[model samples]
Target: MLLPMSTAIAQRISLENHLSLETLRSGAGGEHHFNGMCQAACIASLLCEAGYGTAREGLFGEAERVLLDCRRAGIETENWRFDGKSYRILAEVLTLHDKQLSITPVRELIRANERLKTS
Candidate 1:
């Protein structure tokens, strides 16, 4: 993944694996770490919804995704639903999980959540 000059270079290093993909492609992998975090978060949120809590632990992007999911689920349990933010999160998460890339920015999900007071 290409680490932009604006993002911390430290994010390129995997603290767990101790490997760096930073050296790939002249220090450009044609991807960004934030996108990876979004993909990872989507997967983690799905797994959590599937009753796998362990998947979310320690992942960089899982917290907010989980929070969003929790809010969505809470509304569903209350027999109410959001027309915009809920489906947007669901579609984006599924799209990212399937394609590993999304045209939608994950931050948009956060924004929608904030706008709706869902988180």
Candidate 2:
């Protein structure tokens, strides 16, 4: 029988199995591993480099809210492509919430995504 997991245990599991930038870049697990998940990928990279607090500071909540709002507004949060808007919005949110975060990587990722879209 499958039992429900406690929040603490679930959190630990999530922390341990974070998706990395390399994974996003290589798509080793799948070609679409990063499809429509740019927001999550960004947060995971930050958490991997910094710590859980980087996400706890506010990014997760803000990201969730953005997704929810998009859904409510009947916007299809692309499930087959990189979400550039999410990355851009997340970069801004990071600036507001965590001053110590290095967003250069995020900016670079955004540029890379843009190039992929154009090419």
Candidate 3:
């Protein structure tokens, strides 16, 4: 059986992983990754608008950083691709929240990318 703390950690990791996936998607060209990252950022922004303090700080903050990082890396929004390790790291960070909003769409975006790869 998993301890409560361990379970929480696991959840936190999952969230970060998803967020990283969002970042990768944002970078993948012809793959809708950037759009997906933007969508996730919007979701996080909405949470901030709703006054979820931690969510606003953590999620939205991370989203902003991801955007900035992409820019710094010279990764254009129009030509981005998923980086699996980065996705896992971001998902870990995202999992720290107790709430479960804005994650599903991100997951969908990842799935969509997977589909594209297979097709």
Using TM-score as the measure, which candidate wins? Answer: 3
State the lDDT of candidate 1 residue by residue for 24-112, as single tens digits. 11222222422343344554454344333433234425346543554455445632222344334433444333332222234443443
lDDT of each: 0.35, 0.41, 0.47
Clashes of each: 0, 0, 26
The sequence of per-residue lDDT tens digits that candidate 3 reaches over residues 1-119 is 21123445546644654654665656534334444444445543543444432442465566566656655454444445545544543453344333433233344334444554574
In candidate 3, stretches whose alpha carbon ends up further than 4 angstroms from where it belongs are 1-31, 56-59, 71-89, 92-98, 102-119
Off by over 4 Å in 1: 1-31, 54-62, 65-119
lDDT of 1 at 64: 60
Count residue pairs with overlapping backbones in model 2.
0
RMSD of 3: 10.3
What lDDT tens digits, residue by residue, belong to model 2 across residues 70-111?
Answer: 433333433222145644554454443233223224444344
TM-score of 2: 0.28
Compute the lDDT for candidate 1: 0.35
Q: For model 1, name the residue pairs that clash.
A: none
Q: Find the candidate with the highest lDDT and give its number.
A: 3
